[model samples]
Target: MSTFIAAFLFLLVFFLLMSIGYLIKRKAVQGSCGGLGVLGIEKACDCDEPCDRRKAKDAKEKARQERLAQHRII
Candidate 1:
């Protein structure tokens, strides 16, 4: 029937538009959020070159140890 065909076409168009809208929204969200950061996304700093893993770890451990020693004195 003409009425049935019209209804089906309307629904098909509506759903197609909805799918396109959802895809656009998903892309927008991904663009804004980006990838995860260890500390936080807002405060994360992008370095020029990748950090030296061994030296960084050693420095962090030393700093932590110093903090612990200072706390023990208090």
Candidate 2:
């Protein structure tokens, strides 16, 4: 029937729009990094400062923990 054909066309258009939207969304997702980093996009630091800070903090913590463990062992 004509009604059936119209409905089918409507559904086809709807699905095509949905597919295009999904493709655009997929492309956007692929383009973005999901913001999973220490710095943001604007101030993204590729320098060694953050790495140095992290290493220094880790070393300090390790030294403190080792000192405590040595005391406990005594």
Off by over 4 Å in 2: 27-74
* lDDT per model vs. reference: 0.70, 0.71
lDDT of 1 by residue, 9-71 (tens): 999999888789877664332444455554455423455454688559768989998997888
Q: Model 2 reaches what TM-score against the true structure? A: 0.35
Candidate 2, residues 40-68, lDDT tens digits: the string is 54334555456877679878989998997
Q: In model 2, which residue pairs have backbone atoms overlapping below 3 Å?
A: none
In the predicted model 1, the residue pairs found to clash are none
Provide the lDDT at 26 for model 2: 50
In angstroms, give how far residue 5 of model 1 lies from its true place: 0.2
